[model samples]
Target chain A: MRISQLSAASGVPIPTIKYYLREGLLQPGEQTAATRAEYGEAHLRRLRLIRALLEVGRVPVTAIRQIIAAVEDETMPVHEMLGTAHYALATPVEAAADDDRHREALALVDALIGELGWQVTPEAPTRAELAQVLVRLDRLGRPASVEKLRPYAEHVARFAREREMDSVSGPREAAVESLVVGTVLYGKVLDVLRRIAHESESARRHTSGHPAAPAG
Target chain B: MRISQLSAASGVPIPTIKYYLREGLLQPGEQTAATRAEYGEAHLRRLRLIRALLEVGRVPVTAIRQIIAAVEDETMPVHEMLGTAHYALATPVEAAADDDRHREALALVDALIGELGWQVTPEAPTRAELAQVLVRLDRLGRPASVEKLRPYAEHVARFAREREMDSVSGPREAAVESLVVGTVLYGKVLDVLRRIAHESESARRHTSGHPAAPAG
Candidate 1:
């Protein structure tokens, strides 16, 4: 297939494909002639994964490059590859240095992990991210304790372990591509679903002759 | 209390508070003299909310302004205010005006809402957002049916209905501020929890001598 066909099939535009090729996000197609190149099925699959990450996941271009590198390295074990993809997609939380609040939040996060019996990598960015949100919630006086986070943790763990792991099965490249794409898309799916749920609940409460608020 | 006191109390810097005041994301403190303004407890609360939206939610500044305006419009009913805030925070999905894929997605979303007996607002941005995600997932060959999304929808809806609604209590401004802040931050908290859960699951599978993948 030519570049044009790859573009048509993948729903990606020609110029954008060119941009990706220039940036080495998409591996170069076989040079069939002076200015024409032939893209294969692998190219198409890779292109779709890149677009998914860029558009759906909103992973930065640089991060996408890192994820691609990690995925293509077949020598990497599945667990480490998932971690690389995870790290690439999740921006690190900016935990302040030498801050008492940050230390307290870190301790809480570690404690939560211990209590939940979740063997998160010592430096999984989500740990810091969770800690940061905990600190922020505490500041707001909402104060989400470990117990408060347990429900969310259990919900996602069941989904990831039961559904997500089962979802990633196929030949090596295909499995990896889908895993990388699913990693971000599934999260977005959850986010939109949550929003819709809130909208439904909001509508239900208001329509049931429930006044929205005491002062409203 | 002066702006300095507000900053100290909120842990926000003086210049950032000034910027928020200039942008009207924060209402101006009372003018006391040529170079002085007095901020009350309300200012501190609002400042905390604004930072949470900015840092935790990563909401664009313009969107945050719109959310602030909607939340401040005390006359608006709770449901409508929530709808307004939802619209403000959720960047609209770009559903192509005449794309068949989008049309099909829209129909699917409507059907899903109907099946769930959810009375979502007609123009709820999340409807389009959810539809778009379904389309994207389909293109990835991971077509998530309405059934596939049900579990996530129920999970989030339960959280919103049972916990989130009840969490919003207090005087009017306090209630509204917390609601707006919680709306975004809680989502972040859930997101990190999901990631942590995945990390834990990955560890469990790998440490128990599960091969990460076939060729890895």
Candidate 2:
């Protein structure tokens, strides 16, 4: 297929496709002419996968390149692909860029896993993602202590599991959507709810005549 | 109070204080001399708030600066601050970065609150955090619709709440910890759990007496 045909099949705009090609994210197709190129089913498949990683996984191109390289490498195992995807999905991008704090964050992540006795997978929260937080801390000169994060991790892990239980209804499309929205949006929602929850608690206390004196 | 004194009181280092001063994240203390900068209780207080925004809120310095400025401005309405923080916490950083998408994400979040008939503040994932996925997708384009994300959000959110209900005997410290953990780490954890869930489902289907093709 030609470039336009690939564009039609993949639903990526021609300009975007050209951009990907320029970035070396997508491999060049068969050289049909000095000015034109031909693509194949492989390109189509690659494009779809790319879209999934970007749109759903929200992975960055640099990592995507590495992941695809791993996928294309015959020496690499299928488990490796799954592992990479898992890592790509879970790991943060910052961890990869900053080597100094990456190990520490990983240690924290591991410690949390151990401390909580969580049945978590190998690729939970991409290293880059976690590292990004650490890097920010380093930049802020307030790098979080691993010990400080342990409890945080444990609490979140428990809820992570709980949320999974709530949303995993036969792996339907809607099920995946719930998972994304909950994890992506739940914290803010809870924060809002907690505010109201606090208000309600206060109202109850006031109405019940347990009116605590305001802080002096 | 000197830099060291403020550092000791706030548990922030002198270097970090300097950085905050240089970044204008924290106001400069009274300048005693070329070498000596006298700090005060206000500096300590500012440092604490900065830490809260950076660590707990995971807000960027730029945003933090704006927020702090707004707070200091006084003319800035409380609702605006609430809206900023509300959106900061609830919406994905990248989505919120784009004025249009940010509004849409916020609208959807509001819709969720209304639809669920719950009083909850929706938090957005950080753009730096979400950027990992976007970068990945740029390389590995896949065809995904916004429709698929709904269940993903719901499941994670429900599980988060359920976990909070389970873990917190007192919804104070433990609740706060759970909130952070669930928000930051649950997605990664769920990425792993989903795999296990998929495998378990596969096994169950295969082992059952009823013969059916594998669904994935």
Candidate 3:
């Protein structure tokens, strides 16, 4: 297939496809002639994955490049490849050096991890993210208790298990691609689902004459 | 206090505070003279909220304007105010005017809502969001089932209930502000927590020499 066909099939514009090729996000097609190149099924699949990450997952182009590099590296362990993808997808959370709030947030995260018996490492990007949220919540004078977050964590673990189950079936690279796409895109899915559920619960409580929960 | 003092108090830079004022995300301080204005505690609080929404929640300036408008509207019901905030926070999902995938996704959303006995309206922005995710999942050949999503929804409902509990404690306007802030920022919190949980679960399943779950 020519670049035009790849664009048509993938529903991406030709210029965008050319851009991805230049960015090395898409592998270069076989040069059939001076101005002609041929794409293949793999290119189609890769293009779709890139679109999913960029549009649905909102992953930055630079991060997507890193994720794609991991995906294409056959020697990278599946687990490590996954770690690379996850790290790329995470928004870096910055904290002030030597800030007490940062210290408190880190301690709270450590305590939560211990309480849950979760096996994550101390340096995971999510640790900083969790700390950032905790610090901000504390600043707002509504710090969250572990008791409040435990059930949510348990539920997330279950969802992760389900996602893992969903991603482990295909061939190695394909499976990794699926896992990367699912992890980033499905996070958006979960966010939307939760919002919908919140709307439903709010409607039931406020609009349907089911007496609103008493104000605290 | 002058705008500079408000900036000092909120830890938002003077230029960014001025930007927020220009954007109408923050109300003007009272004009005391030709070039001097006196800001009060309310200005300080509003500046903090603006920063939280922008920096922590990652809400766009335009959406923040709509959210702030809803927050300041005294006549808007509390539930309605919350609806405005949620709508603003949602990533708009555009579907073709006559697309089968769109229809199928809508059907799936309707079926899921009926199955769950949820009270959400058909027109909720989240309805479109849910449909969009379903459509994308289907395109990726990993269509999510109601069975898979139900547990996640249940967990989301629990989180929503907890959020409601937290928001009902303060004065009306303050409660509304708290609800808005919590809804946006806590979504980030939940995302980080879920990522952490996924990392932990991945480690336990793959890195600890435990037998991995069988691929589906």
Candidate 4:
């Protein structure tokens, strides 16, 4: 396929495809002649993944570049690749200026991890991100006690485990790409799903004086 | 109290608070004199809420104004207030150009909502957001069947119900503000927590050659 066909098939514009090619997001197609090149199925797949990350996942192009680099580098351990992808997707939270609140949040996160017996590294980017949320909650004078968040954490753990298992069942490269893409986009999916669920529950609670239907 | 005190209490910079005031996200303080105004507890709380939405929630000022307006409109039903907040927080997804794929994704979302008996409105922004994710998944050639996402939706429903219950225990205005703030921040919190859990699961799976201990 030529660039135009790739754009037509992928629903991306020709100039944007050229931009991606210039940015090295899409590898240069095979040089069939002086002014033309041929793209194969791999190029199409890569373009689709890039579009998903940029448009649906809302990942920045720089981050997408790092994620793609990790996926293509076979020497990088899959675990490390996954870490790269996770970091790329996570929006960096600014650290709280107050040391006391920051330390308190960190300690709370540490205790929660200890209680759950989850083997997360102390340096994981998410630890800081979670701590930042706790700090923000505290500053708002509506701190979320670990006890209050524990059940939700348990549910999150289950979801994460399911995601991990799901990532292991496909071809290695494709699985890695899917894992990264899925992690980013699934967060958005969950957000929308949760909102819909909230609407349902709100209707049930506000319209009637009874609890909602029993959980499945 | 005054603007500086509000800034100090809210931990928002004076310039940012002034910006919010100018943007109509914050109501003007009581006029004490031609050049000075006296801010009260309401101003302080509103300032704090604005800072939370802007700094932590990352909501645009235009959206924050609408959310603030919703919170202040006591005659607005709680359900409508919640809807406004959800709409303000949801990142809109652009529909795919392929009508067939878009329709298929919409049908899948409709079926999922019907199957779950969820009381989501046809115009709910999240319905479109969820459909967009499904479309992106299909474009990637790895469509997420509603059956595959059912258990996740069940869990999301439970979480949403918990959130709704949590929102109802405070003063009406404060509760509405908190709901909006919490919705945005909690989504970030959940993302980080899920990433941490994934790290834990990945560590256990790859390092020990066995699945992690049974999910609690």
lDDT, candidate 4, equals: 0.76
- Minimum summed lDDT over a 10-residue window in model 3 chain A is located at A207-216
Each prediction's whole-model lDDT (CA): 0.75, 0.51, 0.73, 0.76
Q: What is the per-residue lDDT of model 1 for residues B1-216, given as tens digits with 9 covering 90 to 100?
A: 988788888889989988998898999878999998899988877876687667655678987887777668787777776665566667567647548888788888887777777777678888888888788777766776778777777777777787777766565455556666666778777777877777777667756654332211
- Candidate 1 is graded, for docking, as acceptable
lDDT of 1 by residue, A85-104 (tens): 66666766774753787778
Candidate 4 — which residues are off by over 4 angstroms? A1-81, A92-104, A162-164, A209-216, B1-40, B56-73, B209-216
Displacement of the residue A111 alpha carbon in candidate 1, Å: 1.7
Rank the candidate models, highest TM-score first.
1, 4, 3, 2
- In terms of docking quality, model 4 is acceptable
Q: Name the runs in model 3 displaced over 4 angstroms.
A: A1-76, A94-100, A145-148, A162-165, A208-216, B1-77, B92-107, B138-148, B162-169, B208-216
Scored by lDDT, model 3 comes in at 0.73
Regions of model 1 farther than 4 Å from truth: A1-47, A50-76, A95-98, A138-142, A209-216, B1-76, B94-98, B138-142, B210-216
Residue pairs that clash (backbone atoms under 3 angstroms), model 1: none
TM-score of 4: 0.75
- lDDT, model 3, position A65: 86
With candidate 3 superimposed using the best TM-score fit, by how many Å does residue A156's alpha carbon deviate from the native?
1.3
Give interface RMSD, every candidate, in order: 7.9, 11.7, 7.5, 4.1
Q: Which window of ten consecutive residues has the lowest lDDT sum in model 1 chain B?
A: B207-216
